[model samples]
Each structure stands twice: as structure tokens, then as C-alpha cells.
Target: MATLNLGILAHVDAGKTSLTERLLYAAGVIDELGSVDAGSTRTDTLELERRRGITIKSAVVSFPLRGTTVNLIDTPGHPDFIAEVERVLGVLDGAVLVISAVEGVQAQTRVLARTLHRLRIPTLIFVNKVDRAGARFHELLDEVGARVSPALVPMSRVDGLGTRDAAVTERVDLLRLADHDDAVLAALVEERTPPPVRAHDDVHPVFFGSAITGAGIDALIGGIVDLLPTGRAPGRGGTVFKVDRGPAGERIAYLRMFDGVLRVRDTVGEDRVTGIRVFTDGGTQPRAELTAGQIGTVRGLGHVRIGDTIGVRDAKAQQAQFAPPSLETAVLASRRAELHAALAELAEQDPLINLRQDDERREVYVSLYGEVQKEVIQATLAEQYGLDVSFRETTTLHIERPAGAGAAVEYNKVAPNPFLATVGLRVGPGDGVSFQLAVEPGSMPAAFFVAVEQTVRETLRQGLRGWPVPDCAVTMTHSGYSARQSHAHAVFDKSMSSTAGDFRNLTPLVLMAALRDAGTVVHEPIHAFTAEVPADTVPAVLPLLARLGAIPLATGAHGIDGEIPAAKVHELRRRLPGLTRGEGVLESVFDHYAPVRGKPPVRERTGPDPLDRKEYLLRVVNRRLTPSQSST
Candidate 1:
């Protein structure tokens, strides 16, 4: 049977989770429908999610329909938990972008649609809540076509819309899909049944339904089988979208295979798959193997990382289709050590949190998307890890980029370079962190070169101003190594031969000098926001937004669309409800980074500071400093 990994996604309160429940019930996987209000939804398994009546984690459920086993991933709708949605995107064979008919098109709705279009994932638009009052059908279609994609084809027309008796009548327009391709157009002209396949990006089919009353679900199911792509691809690797800890505290990796087979006991990359649990029509069944186009839980990959490839990799298997957290908050806790330890483990599951420590001040910091995410993290730490932590005010997470090209080199046995290895590097701006070689591969031992390159990257983590320098082009300009020299008698000797550790110890000093010469400028995160508010509140809101350094560009019936610094997003959110009498709905997404207007905020240097020459030499070369970072 063919398998399809479908995603059920929407903005918060758009009924995305309810739709997931309805699909499961319609497929007979569940005897009855589960309610989001009652906190009985199958996909919302987390207690936190039940209490908040929102999806916090992306939960996977499986059901069978029309000879296809569909693994429906119910992803979090909160933009705060969008990292969950981002992880789920790369694994989807097709998606159904849900919109609230009463709400029309929302800000997060627009974001999701744009991303789906960019990825060219085959998508179906579902205008939900047709049974609710204030539902608008034709207007929503016009809005979707104008604001979202104009290539929308309505598969069915709504009858009795905006009432409890709402129904969907089948009304396919074969001609509407003609513009998607010439072949389909020619087939239509010749009165031939055109090929059923449609371009994922070019043409989109729209469905109207209500998850509450189960109206129009049959048509949606048909769309799933008819419109979506089935996974039967060739190749031999999978993408790891999620990771969890087992009962024994071991890592459990949730992998979606793009192609080929993976069996228990098979070695994939550096780890072996010791156990497998495939999500099938009847729920997770422990199995000996996992095949192409299936998602499963694999155990015993002790070092498996999220987004890392398993087996021979293809481009789709390793694409970093994720974004980094743009805001960070300092966690203040009485049990600071425990909080740090817990955050470290949490970081393993969601690496974007990027736990960092201020060793000197004994403080812990965690990155976040917004205030809601900070709340979730606080709640999680309190309930799950038993640590009561309060976060400081959120701040923009800044990063530094190399200002200019600079080069530096240290020769082996030189006075300042005490290590018995020579390393050289040139730093400059690039698309992202990349390392190339000016020296031949045969110039030194591969391990030594590996050591130099690794240290160069590690050193760049905390640049001259202590902000991360993740984007730069680094080239290894020179290399030298001590030949293995030993006495006639085969005896252990450390003074004669250069170890990888020697290259590691000396690389920081050389790379830091290059960074000093190159210089850097700190860039702060900027976000674009769309706010839907009462028409009367726009006058009051524009000034408040302007005070927070927002540039309001367009004004619609809802409110204003503009760009604001990410640092001000929380403030905007806090003040908007009051200004609009609790009717204002604001959605914001990270746009880009611009140079800070004034002095950039500095994060206290952690581990060893390579910029300090005497301290770095004393700590690294002489081994006088306590082990800051174990590179050897």
C-alpha cells in the first residue's frame, strides 16, 4: 500500500487540531470524534497542550483511506511553537493549509501559505467553519486568491453556508486546472481525460468544510487520495525531524524516510538502528524494519542528531529547512544548576533553543521565538523538570558578520606560537560558514587539517564582540606539521611529534587575530507584523507602533502591516489588546537583520576568550587554566 505523510496545519484557534481528530474518526481509526475544548484530542497528548487547549508538540497519528496509509501530523498552530511546524514541513508529501472562514485569511495563514508555495509542496486549501456565523465563502476565495495564490480551484461549492446545516456539493471544474500545464490544456481541448497529476506549486484545489460537524470530510479524503502525491521514491536515506528521550533516558529519533529500507541492526552513518516502531493504520507497531516513505521511531542511534541524515543521504534528506530562534531570555532560578542541566537535555530535542551558560556569573540563558514560547519553557521547566525559573525581559539575539578580509598565520615552534604545529586561516564574509583550502590536502595529515578546521569553527562561535559569527568564508591558507620523530628505541615521546591537540591549542590564537583584523558589526533581528484591529483603533495604534520603532506601510480593514524590531514584538503584543479592546490580533515573523542603531548588547564571554592573548596562551599552551573546553 502507498503511504502519504500529510500535515494538518493552521493558525491558533483555526481548528487545525479539531480537523485532525475528525479525519481520524472518519477513517474509523477512532470510534468517536475527540474535542479540543474537552481536551480529549488524540494528537494533543501533552497535558500542557490539553490545559491550554492548544497543540504544543507536533503529534503523529495514522489512518487508512482508499488503499493509502496516511500518517497525519498535527502541528502546533501557535507561532511561538512554529519550530515544530518547521520541522514537519520537510517530511510532508502534501499539505492541507486550513483557514478560518469567519477569520478569512490571517497573518500566520499567509506565512504558512507562502512557505508551502516556496517549497512547492502539493497543497489543498480548506476553508473551515462554514457552519459558523459570519462565515463568508466568495469573499474568502477572493481574499485567498488576491492575498495567497491566485491558482486556486474550488473542488466543491458550499450549500447552506454560514449555518449549522452547511453542506458541500461536488462541483469540479476541469477547465480551472488547465493553466497549470499545456498537456492538461491540450487534453481538455481534445475532450480527453487529462493526466490526473497536478503541479504542486502551479495549481491548488480549495475545499470547504467544518471539522465540528464532519461536513465535507469525504471530499477532503478524496482530495488526499486524488490530489496529493504518493511516496514511492527511489533512494536510501531518511530525514530526522523529531527526537525524544526513552524511558531509560536514551535517545528516540523520529525519522521520516524519503526512500529505501532500514532494518533493525543496520548501521546507518555512525549509529545502528537497534529497534524500530512503525506508525501504521492501527498505531505504532514495533517492527524489525522501516521502509521508504514511512515515519518511525528508531532506538539505539545514541548519537543521532535532529536534521541529520541516516544512511546514504540525498539533498532533501539533509536540507536545513528550519529557522533559528531570534529572541533569548535569561533564566533566573534558585536551582540554577538544575535548570541548566535540564535545558541542556531540552536543547538536544529542540536544538534551536540553543542553551548557553554564563559560567562567571553562574547564569543560564535559553533562546526563544517569543513570549509565549518563554511561557511554555517556564511551564515545562516547572512541571516536568521541577525547577521554578523566572525569565528576565526578552532581548533580540544579535549576531556578528565579518567586516573585511583578513589573514593570519602562526608557524610551528615560533616564539608566540608555542605549539609544535603551524596553522593559517583567512576570514571573509560569505553566505554561511564555509571552509576551503589554499594548501594541498597532502600538505599535512588529514586529522591535523581536520583539527585546525574544527577549531576555527568552534573559535568563531564567540567572535570579537562575543556575539556568534555564523556566516563567514574561512580558508586554510597554510599548514605545517612536525614529522614523527623518535629515538632508535621505540619509546613514547610527546616533545618530538605534533599531536592533533597541538593544532587545536594554537588555532584559536591565529584565528582570533584574523577576526580582529577583519572586524565585525552586530546585527539585530527585525520582524514584519500584521495586525487585525478595530477600525477606530488604527489612529491610536499607529503612534504606539511608531514609538516602538515600527514602520507602518499599509493599512487594511483589519489594521496595519509594517516592520518592527523583534525586540519590540512582545511590547506590541502586550499593548495591542488594550488598544483595540481585546479584539486586536497581531501576527509577527522574523524578517531580517539590520545593524544595530547604537551600542550592541554584549553577552559575557563563556568558556575561553580567544581575543585575550596572554590569558589564552596561559590557559591553552601552558595548560594553566582549568579545562574550559575539551578540544583534545
Candidate 2:
């Protein structure tokens, strides 16, 4: 049987876990169905997830359906947990996007669909909760088309409306026919046609069912077997999307194989892989050989990191198909009265998460998505890492311009050993946003130049105001250092920090926070939602949108005009209590960091340093001065 590695994803509380429960039960993996509200869902096993009744961490489960082994990666629905979604997309060959029937397509649904589309993962849509009250089948299908995909395949149609006793009809062939283009459309003009395989359909397969009442599950299961993609082996190699703490704190990486077969104890070169773990709805089992195009976990690969590819001995010889994004921002420890050692260790575990300290700002920043992510990092530091950590709001790294032809700063200006070097430096914008730095040729030893390069990176650990130094280039044209006095460590400090400071001073515009700017406007996350409440509730909800700072784009014309509302996170959290009121679930993603219009409000700053600057100055001067020079 073909192993189909598919992800079960949706907006939070869109019944993804519940559907998984039902799918598992139907496949006899579970004796009974687990509930999400009650927190018995298999995928939502984490303590934080269980307490909140959401999927914070991605869970892996597999089951058999019609001779196909369907491996499902259940991911978190809340926007805060989007990293889980982004990481999972790396491994998934395809995805089953669940759109709540009662709520139709929501803001998060649209965001996730866009991401899936970008990842080029073939998708299958599931319109769930058809048995719920206020369910509008046709209207919901229309919303799917408008919001998610125009080529959505609607396989099963509901017999009745809302909770008026709905039954699923086997309309797979009709939906598949609708997926074809005009040329294919003309072929369908004939009386009867041989039903094309699900893969041949130009559109994604869309199935309808109520996960709660188990309505239409069997047919949906059958469709999954028929429509889902199939593959025999892994690709050339595989990419590691996420690393999870397994039983006993063992690091188990959930990976997707792209092109090569992975066996037990196989090494990604010299890195030894001890074993492979396979998870299913029946719980996790062991596997020996996972070929290309498969998803499995490798055990005891200590050297493996996220985005690492493991395959044949000469796998690197094979052209790499997957290209992971490079590290954008670097975050480090905050400089306060005290430092936390645990925080440093946390940063060490995730090399993608780098850290550097800035003596000038006396702060450490850990690069992240945004301010909200900063808050999450703080929480993680406190709760998981057992440390009291705080963060300054994130700022992007910016580059510095050179004084003239080139610029270079030397370390060892004082006591430790007086090593001095001055090399001209110039900074200019390159092809992209990152600035390029160039150094003068043969100005310093190959060893010394490498030290300079390392320093620049460290200096970027904390830029002028403690933010990362953005992309920029630096060139050292002419530099000289004391042959006897300059050490590798000292040069590293001076070069990096000085270059960082120079860049900061030369450039007037520091790296600004990446606000969601589009055209002449900045856009914040606006939840494009469709809520199917009673007609009486529509008027009540419309006013609530204004209170939430959301603009109602349009309301559905069918039964209860469901409006696609766009609202901010803070406003939505506050207004959703009264808006949802046991009526619907809301799904939204980080739309764009819209701009704050007008003069742009200035931030309030705290004045007066409590700590003596003299103390810091003394440390700097004392470190720089030599004992013999002090006497002189």
C-alpha cells in the first residue's frame, strides 16, 4: 500500500482533532471517538494544549483507509501557533484543509490555504460540521471557492439544510467533473465519461461531512483513498521541519522524506541515526526503512538540525529541490541587572535561533516574527526554561555606510594589549534589502581577516540600539594591527562591535520593524470570516464588527447574510466573547503588519540610568590599557 503523508489542518476549533478521532475510530484504530472540548483528543496531548483545548504542537498519527496508509499530521489552529503550520508544510506532500461548514471559510482558513498553495502541496478540502445548526451547505461551498480555491471539488452534498436532518450524498463524480478546465469541460459534454482519477482533476477534492455526528465519514474516507496522492519512496533526501521532545526528553525530529530511502541507524553522512519512529492513530510504532516521499522520525541524530537533508552518502551530489529560507533575524539575551544561564541554553538548542550580547545597549535580543512572538518567547523562557526573562520589542537589523572608500575599526586600543588597525570601509545596498560589506584585499592576514568577519557577525548580535544589524556589507581596504599585542579574541570583539557601531552611526534610518506595508497602505491582520448565525443575530453582529475595529467587507446573500469580517488580534480577542457567544469559531492569521498612520506616535522612554555609567567605562578602559602603558 502507498503511504500517503498528509496533514490535517484547519483554523482552531474547526473540528480537525475531532475529525481525526472519527477517522481513527472508523478505521478501528481507536475503540471510541475522542472529544476536543473535553480535551481527550489524541493530537492535543500537550499540557498547554489540553488546558486550552487547542493543538499547540503538531501531532503525528497514521491510519489505513482503502489500502492506503494515511499519515496525518495534526497541527495547531490558533494564529500564535502558526510556526507549527509553517514547519509542517515543509514535510507534507499534501494537505486536507478543513473548513467549518457553519462558519464557512475564515480568515485563518484563507491564510493557511495561501501558504499551502505557496508550498505547492496538492490540497483536498473538507467542509466539516454540516450537522451543526445554522449550517449552509451551498453558501459555505461558495465561500470556499471565493476564499480558498476557485477549483474546489465539492464531493458530497447535504440533503437538508442546517440541523434539519442532513444526509450525505455520494456526489464525488460531479465535483470531480467540475474540477476540469474548458478543454476537459468539452470532453465532459458527451453523455457519459470514464471518471478521471482524483489526481487528474485540475482542482482540489472537496468533501462535506459532520465530524460530530459521524455523518458522511465513510464516503469521505473512501475519497481520501481515491483522491490523495501516492508515492513509493522518499525523494533524494529529506528535510527536518520540527524537533519535538519525545519521551525522556529524547529529541525526535518529525521529518518528511523528499527523495531517498532512510533506514534504521542510517547516518546523514557522519551523524549517526539510531532508529526510526512511526506514529499512527493506533499510537506510534517502529519502522526500519522509510523511502523517499515518506514522513517519519529519526532517533539519536544529535548532529541533525532543522532544514538538514539526510539521504544517500552522495545525496549532496543530487540537486537539492527544497530550499529553506536563511536566518533572517538574530535574537540574544537581554542585558538587565542579571542574566539567565538557562536562556542561553535554550538559544543554543535551536541554532536557527541565534543570540549575541550588546555591551553598548546592555541588552540581548532573540530574533523572532514580531512583538507577539517576543511575548511568547518570554513566556517560554519563564515556563519551560525556568527563567525570568524579558524582551524589548523587536527591531530589524540595518546596515551602516562607510566613511569613504572603506572603514575599519581595530580592537586592543588599551590595556589588554594595544592592537590597532584602521581599514577603510564602505557600505551600500545590494540587490536585496541586506547591505553588503567589502574589505580591502591583502590588508590583513587571511587569519586576521577571518577574525574580522566573525567579529562583524558578533557585532550584529546587538546593533546600535540593541536590535540586530540588518543585511549590509563591509570591506576592509587598509588595516594594521600590533603584531605582538592583538589576539584573536580581542580582534573579534573590536572588529564586530566597531563595525556594528559604525554602521549604526553612518546610516540615519535604522532597520525599522517590518510593518505589513502594501502599496501606499499598511495592512493589519483582518479576519475574513463567514459566520452563519440566526437572521436576528446578523444585525447584532454587524455592530460588533465596528467595535472590534473590523470592517465588514460583504455579507452573504443566501440565508443569514454572513459577512467576511476583517479584525485585528487584540480587538478580536476582546470582541469575540460577545460575538461568538456559543455561535461560531473565529480563524485568523497574521495578515500584514499594517502601518500606524499619521505622524506615527512616538514611544515613551524611561529617563535617567540607575546604574553608574562610570562603572562600565572603567571596565572598558581597564580592559583596553596595558600595565606598562598605565605607568607611562
Candidate 3:
């Protein structure tokens, strides 16, 4: 049977989980429908998700449609869990974007739609909640066209007058089909096969449905089978998008195979897969082999990470573009010793959590998406690890860049210079963080040159500000090696004196001197936000926006769109509802990093100041410096 990997995405509370339950039920995979409000949904398996009535992580379920096996990934709609959504996007063949009929297009809905369009994932729009009162089909359709895309073609329309009994019927309007692709237009002219709604940039087919009553579900399922593209035959590669622990504490790697069959005991990278399992309605079933376009979990790959490609050791895994966490809070624990180990376990699940420790202050810090995420982390630690923990006050995570170009040199011949390697480095601003090793042709052996370049890149991780250097470039301007040493009788020694470790040890001093000479400028993260409210609330919200250093992009009767510092978003979330009498909706995503217009707020230094030569050299020479001392 052909396989299709379909993803269900939406804004929060848009009946996304309901639609998934309905799809499984209609396919005979489930006997009864599970309710999201009752926390009985198959996709939401977490206790926290059950209590909060929200999806905190992405879940997978599978069912048969026609002769095809459909693997569905129900992604979290809440913006706080966007990282989860991002990881799934890289593996989907197509996506179903759910928009509530009553609410029409929302902030997160637009975000998801734009990302889908940018990623060029062929998408279908499901206008759900047609059973709710005050749901307007035509008006909502118009809103979708204006807000989402003008390329949407309605494949079905609402047949009932009221939402309570609304039904969907196939009624393709010929007049509305003109703006679609040539393949679709030609199919209409020939009156042969219906134009294929391909998974591409153009022509998103819209379907109206009430997932609660299972109305219009048949059409949606049929559309997925007919409209969505199937995966190519298995090749020799795939990507690992999720990592979890098995019931027996073994590592599990959830992978989406792009090509090639993966078998039990097959070696991927350095680790061998001990087992493979595919998802079923009831749970997982053991499978010895997974083919192309299939999503399955593999065990015994302990060193594998999310986004790692299996079966191909040299191929590069596509990096997921996720919004950086804007908030930072210190992690406090009752059992201080076990704190680091517990955090390492949590970081394995979501690398974005970014756990850091400060030896000077003896404190731990974690990066978070928002306050709610912070609460979830606390709850997770308590519930899963039995570790009681709380967070310190939240703060903005800032980054810095080089203020100017500079260079430095370390001479091995100098007295007490530490080793036999001589290195020189130059630093300057670049598009982003990058490194290159350049030298006069045959300045040194390739082995020594490679070692110097690798050491330089690793050392550049932290800059003068003690934060990971951003928008900077480093180059190896020069390198040197000592000639073969001779004994007192003029007999040559067999072993070479220079090593990669020597360059690594001397790298900090030279790189630090270069950075200190260049100086630094800090940049703060900014967020583009949209606030929806009643007309009367606009005036009250504008001042609050101004107070938060927001720059308005557009203002209308019902809402305002603007950009603000990400640091202020948590505050806006707290104040907007009160100002608009609990009727306002606010959503923000990381926009860009901009130079601080005034005196930048002081940040806690994560490492020794490179400009302070004495303190930095002493720490590096004494081996007191650690790799984790720098914040990224």
C-alpha cells in the first residue's frame, strides 16, 4: 500500500484534536470518538496536556484510508510549543491547516500558514467548528482568502442554513477556478480527471466541516488520499526528528524515512538499531523494517540527536529553523547535586530548553518560551523526576557582535609561551557567526593547519561580552610549526613535538586579545506581534504598546499589528487581557535582533572578560576555564 505522511496543524482551540479523532473514527481505526475537553484524545497522552486541555507535544497516529496507510502527526498549536511543530514540518509530505469557522483567521493561524507557504508544503484548509452558533461560512471563507492566501479554491461548500445541522457537499465553482494552476485549469477544460490539488505553493483546497458531528469528514479523508502526494521509493537515508526514552529506559529515536529501508540491527552512524516499531491505533507494533515515507521509532541509538540523519553518515541533516527562546530563568532545586543530571535528561527531549550552569555564582539557568512553559518545566521536573524546583525571576537573553576589526598573534618562541605552536587570528563582523582558516600556501602541514582552524572555531564560541558571538567572522591569518628537534649528538627524535592540543591551549589568549581589541555591541531580540480587540480597546492598548517600546506596523478598528522587544512580550501577555476586558488576543514571535538604542541593560557575565589579560590568562593557563563557561 502507498503511504502518506500528513500533519494536522492549527491555532489553539480550533478543534484540531477533534478533527484527528474524527478522521481515525471514520477510517474504522477507533470504535468511539475521543474528546479533547475530556482529555481522552489519542494524540494528547501527557498528564499535563490532559489537565490543561492543550497539546504540549506532537503525537503520531496511523490509520488506513482506501488502499493507503496514512501516518498523521498531530502538532501542538500553541505558540509556546512551536519548536515541536517545527521539528515535524521537516518530515511531512503535506499538511492540513485547521481554521475555526467562528474565529476565522487568528494570529497563530497566519503564522502557520505563512510558514507552510514558505516551506512549499501543499496544504488543505479545514474550516472546522461549523456546528458552533454564529459561524458564518461565506464570511469566514472571505476572511481566509484575505488573510491566508488568494490561491485557495473551495472544493466543497456548506449545505445547511444553520451551523447545528450544517453538511458539506461537493460543489466546485468553475468561475472561481480560473486563478488556479494550469494543470487544474486544463483538467477543467478537458473534463477528464479532476485537477490534482498538488502539494505545492499554489492552489490550497478549502473544505468546510464540523469535526464534532463528523460531518464533511469523508470528503476530507478522500481529498487527502487523492490530493496529497505519495512518497518516493525507499532510498538509503532518513532523518531523526524526535528522541525519547523507552519504557525500559532505552533510547528511542523517532524517524521519518525519506528514502531507503531501515532494518533492525542496521548500523546508522556508530550505533545499531536494536528494535523498530510503527505506530498503530492501540499503540506501537514491532516492525523489523521501515520503508520510505514511513514514520517509526528505533531503539538502541543512544548517541543519535534530533535532526540527525540515519543510514547516511556523510550526508548533512537539514537544520530546523526555530524561534529562539526569549526568556531566561535560573533553576533552583532542593536537591542541588542532582539538578544538573535531571536537567540533562530534560534537555534530551527539547534541546531548546538550553540548560546552563554558573560556577562563580553556583546557579543554573534555563531558557524558556514563556511563563507557561516555565510552569510546565517545573511541573515536569516534579512529576517525572520527583525533583522539586522553582525558577528565579525571568530576564531577556541578549547577544553581542564585534564592534570593529582586530588581530592578534601568539609566538611559540617567547619565554613561557606554553607550547611549540605559533598561531595568528583576525576577527571582523560578518553576516552571521562563521569561521575560516586561511594561510600562505604551505605555511604549515595540513594536519597542523586543520588543527588550528578547528581550535579557533571552537574557541570563538564565546566573545568579550561572555555571550556567544553573533554576526562575526574569524580567520586564521597565519600559523607556524617547529622544525624537527635533534638530540645533543645531532640524532633526530622520532616523535613530533607539536599537537592539536597546543593550538587549542594557546587559542583563547589570541582570540580573546582580538575580540577585546574589536570591542562589542549588544543586540536585543525583537518580536513582531498582533493584538486583536474591540474598537474601543485600541486607544488603551496603544499606550501600553508604546510603553513597551513597540513600533506599530498597522492599526485598525479591531486590532493592531506591531513589533516590540521580546523581553516585553510576557508583560504584554499579562496586561493586554485586562486592558481589553479579557476580550483581547495577543500573539508574538521572534522578529529580529536590533541594536539597543540607549544604554543596554546590564547582563550577568558568564565568563571572564577577555579584555582583562591577567585574569583571563591565569584562568586559561591554570585549567580553570571550562567549555560550558560561555553562554550561547
Candidate 4:
């Protein structure tokens, strides 16, 4: 059977999960309908998700539609878990974007719609919650056209909406509407057969429905099967998008097979698939094989990580970059030694939860999107790992960039160098952090090239500002190794040795010297935000935003667009509700890094400063001096 990978995306509380449950019921995949409020939905199985009535992670479910298999991916609508949505977007053949009939187009709705459009994923819009009071189809449709895309054409019109028996009637020629490129229209005029809807087309077919009452669901499903295109055959390669643990504590890699078949025990790269499980109406069933255009879980892939491509050596799965975590908090635990171990497990699930250790402070820090995510982490630890933990006050995570350009060199064979390698490098500002090994033939053995390049890239992790450096370029202008020379071993002969370790050790010293000469500037992450408020409150909100260093973009009758420092978003979130009498809507997304205008707050250093030559060398090379001893 042909397969289709469809994603369900929406703004928070827009009935996205409800819509998924309805679709599953409509397809007869489930005997009874599950409600999001009751926490019985198939896609949302997490305890935290059930309790909170929100989807915290993307979940995949499959069911038969007509003669085709539809692999549905239900993505988290909450902005905090947007990373989950981003991971699934790379694998979708099409998407059903859910919008609330009552709420009209929301900030997140626009974000999702624009992203789907930009990615060129053919999308259908579902105006859900038609049963809710204040639901207006015409107004919502206009809002969608104005806020989302103008090319959105209505597939049907709802009569007696917000009632028990709302009826839908076909309003447009779907074949023509789906003919976004006018190919179908041309075919009709030329007396030739019109083609099926192209999945990459810009035109979006909008469907009106109430997911709760199951109104207008059949039409939506029919639209999907008839209008959406069946994807090409899967390739042998696929990307691991999620990692979980089975009942036996074995690793489970959730993958979207792009091409080729993956069989049980098939060795893809270095990892072997010990087992395969494909989703079915009756839960996952063990499968001997998985073909292309399928989403399934595989076991025994211990080293596989999110965004890793299976069956392809050294290939990286391309995914949309998520916004950097703007806030961080210290993890407070009584069992200090076990904290890192527990966090490592959490990091395996959500790589965005970057865990850092502060040896000097004897504390653990974690990156976060906001306070809600912090609470989730705290709860996750207590529930899953049985480790109770609290968090200190949150703080901003700052990054640095190069201010100029310079060069440095380290000759390992010389006295006091304490190694058998020679390295030289140059540093300058670039669009982002990057490394290149520019070497002349015979300058170094071919075997040493990879080691030298890897070492340089690793060393760039730390910069003079005590944060990961960004927007800088490093190139290895020179590299060498000591010739085999004999030295007295015991009382007569000498020995010679050359290893990659020497190059790795010397890398820090040379790179730091270059960074110091080049100088560095710190930049803080900023966010572009939009706020919808009462028309009368726009004036009041303007000055408040200005006080927070926000630059106004546009002032509409009931909304304002602006940019603000991400660090101050929490303050805005706390105050916006009361200012607009609970009717206001505020949305913020990471924009770009801007240079700190004045004195910047200091951040805790992660490692020894490379500029401190003697201390760094003693700490890294000698390994005898403790952190305190080396500093002293």
C-alpha cells in the first residue's frame, strides 16, 4: 500500500490533539473516541503529558485510510516543546494545520503556517472547535487568509456551525483548487487528463470542522486521501529523530525511513537493529522489516542519537535549528555525585537540556526555554529517576564572538613545550563558528590531518569570555611533527615518539593566544515578539516595552510587533495579562545575537582560560595540579 507521512500541528489548546483522536476514530482505528481532557489519547501517553493535558513530545501513530497507510505524527503545540515539532517537520510529506474557529489565527498558528509554506510542504487547514461559542467561520477564514496565506482556498462551507448537526457542503472544484500551478486547469482546457494534487504546491485547502463533536471529519479524511500526494518510495537511508527506552531498558530509536528497507539485525553503520516495531491500530507489532516511507521503532541502536542518519556512514540528518535556550538554572540535589549521572539520562531524551557542571560552585546547571520547562525537568527527575531536585533562580546564557583577527603557533619539540608535534593557526571573525585545516602537502602526514582538525574544533568550544565562541573562523595555517630522533633511554640510547595527543594538548595554548590577540566581544540573545492587546492599551504597552529595551516594529489597532532581550521576556510574560485584562496575547521567538552595549554581567567560566598559559598548561598537560592548585 502507498504510504503518507502527515503531521498535525497547531497552537496550544487549539484542539490539535483532539483532532488527532478524531481522525483515528474516524478511520476505525480505535473502538472508542479518546478525549484530550480525559488524558486517554493514544498519542499522548506520558504521565506528565496526561496530567498537564498537553503534548510534551511528538508521537507517531499509523492507521489504514482507504488503501493507503497514513503515518500520523502528532506534534506538541506548546511553544516550549517546539523542538519536538521541528524534529518531525523534516520527515513530513504533508501536514494538517489546525486553527481554532473561536480564537482565529494565533501567533503560533502564523508561525506554523509560514514554516509549512516556507518548507514547501503541501498543507490543509482544519478550522476546529466549530462547536464552541463565538466560533465564526467567515472571520476565521479571513484571519487565515490575512495572517497565514492568501492562497488558502476553502474546500467546503459549514452550515449551522456550533450546533449538534453542523453540515458541510463542497464549495470549490478541489481538482482545480489543488492545481496550484494551473496544470490541472490547462489539462481541462486542452482536453487532456488532469493530474493529482502536487504536495509541493502553494495552494492550501481549508476544511471546517469540530474535532470534539466529530463534525465534518469524514470530509477531512477524504480530502487527505484524495488531495495529498503519495510520497516516493523510501530510500535505504533514514534519520533517527527520537530516542527512548524499552521495558527492558534497551535503547529504542524512532526513525523515519526515507528510502530502502531495514530488516531485523540489519547493520546500519556501526549499530545493528536487534528488533523492529511498527505502529498499528492495536499498538506496536514486531516487524521483521521496515520499508521506506515508514516510521517505526528499532532496538539495539545504543550509539544512535537524534538527527543521526542510519545506513549512511558519517552522514548527519538535516533538521531545522531550534531557538537557543535563553535561560539557565542551577540544579540543586542532595545527592550531588549522582546528579550528573541522572542528568545524562535526561539529556539523552532532550538534547536541548544542556547540563553543565560548576566544580568551583559545586552545582549543576541546565539550559531551559522558560520556567515551565524547568518545572518539567524537575518533575521528570523525581518521577523517572526517583531523584528529587530543585532549581535556583534562573539566569541568562550569554555567548561571545571575535572582535578582530590574529594568529599564534606552538612548537612542541622545543624546550618546555613537552610534546612531539608542531601546530600553528589563524583566527578571524566569520558568520559563525567554523574550522578549517589549510595545510600544504608533506607539512604533516595524512593520518594526522583528521586528528589535528578535530582537536582544533573541540578547542574552540571555550573562548576568552567563558562561553562558547560564535561567529569565528579558525584555519590551520601550519602543522608538523618531530622527526624520529634517538635519545638515551637508560644509559646509552635515546627514544623518539610522535602522537596525536601532543597536537591536541598544544592546540589550546596556540588557539587561546590567537583569540586573545584577536580580542572578543560578548553578545546577548534577543527575541522578536508580538503582543495582541486591547486597542486602548496599545499606548500603555508601548512605554512599558520601551523600558525593557524593546524596539517597536509596527503598531496595529489591537497589536504591536517589537524586539526585546530574551532575558526580559519573563518580566513581560508576568505583566502582560493584567495590563490587558487577561485578553492579551504575547508571543516571543529568538531573533539574533546583538553586541552588548555596555558593561555585561559576568558568567561562570566552564574551563581554565587558555590565555592563562602557565596555569592552563599545568592543569591540562601536567594533570597533577587540581583546579584550585592550578589557579593559585
Task: Choose the strongest candidate by lDDT.
Answer: 1
Q: Could you tell me how far off, in angstroms, the CA of residue 81 lies in candidate 1 after the best superposition?
A: 1.8
Lowest lDDT block of 10, candidate 2: 510-519
Instruction: For each candidate in turn, give its C-alpha RMSD to the true structure in angstroms.
Output: 3.5, 8.2, 4.3, 3.8
Error of 2 at 329 (Å): 17
Best by TM-score: 1
Residue-level lDDT of model 2, residues 218-336, one tens digit each, is 87787778776765223467777677666576667777776767788776666667888765546666888776655777888765565566653233222223111111233344445
* Candidate 4 residue-wise lDDT at 581: 85
**Cα RMSD for predicted model 4:** 3.8
lDDT of 2 at 118: 57
Output the lDDT of residue 20, model 1. 91
Question: Model 4 Cα displacement at 146 (Å)?
Answer: 3.0
Candidates 2 and 3 compared by lDDT, better number? 3
Displacement of the residue 367 alpha carbon in candidate 2, Å: 7.3
TM-score of 2: 0.69
lDDT of 1 by residue, 79-196 (tens): 8888889888888889998999999887678788888887778898888999999998888887888778877788888989999999988776656556646887899899998776
lDDT of 4 by residue, 1-632 (tens): 88898999999999999999998888888888887888899899999999999999899999999887899999998877877887787777789999988887776787788788777777888988887878887777667877887666677788887666777776654443434446666877787875544345478888888888887788788888888877732335787778887777677889988887889988877778889998766368999998788889999888877878766422222635456677889999999887888898778877878787888788988888777788888888888778899889998888878889989876755655665778788999996667786778577776666776676666665678677675789988878886555556534222256666777777777788888889888888888788989989887888889888889898876498888998888888788888888988888877778887788666767666566766777767765644443341
State each model's CA lDDT, in order: 0.84, 0.56, 0.79, 0.79
Predict model 2's lDDT versus the native.
0.56
Between prediction 1 and prediction 4, the one with superior TM-score is 1
- Give the poorly placed runs of model 4, Cα more than 4 Å off: 162-165, 173-201, 232-236, 313-317, 414-418, 445-447, 483-496, 623-632
Q: Give the TM-score of candidate 3.
A: 0.90
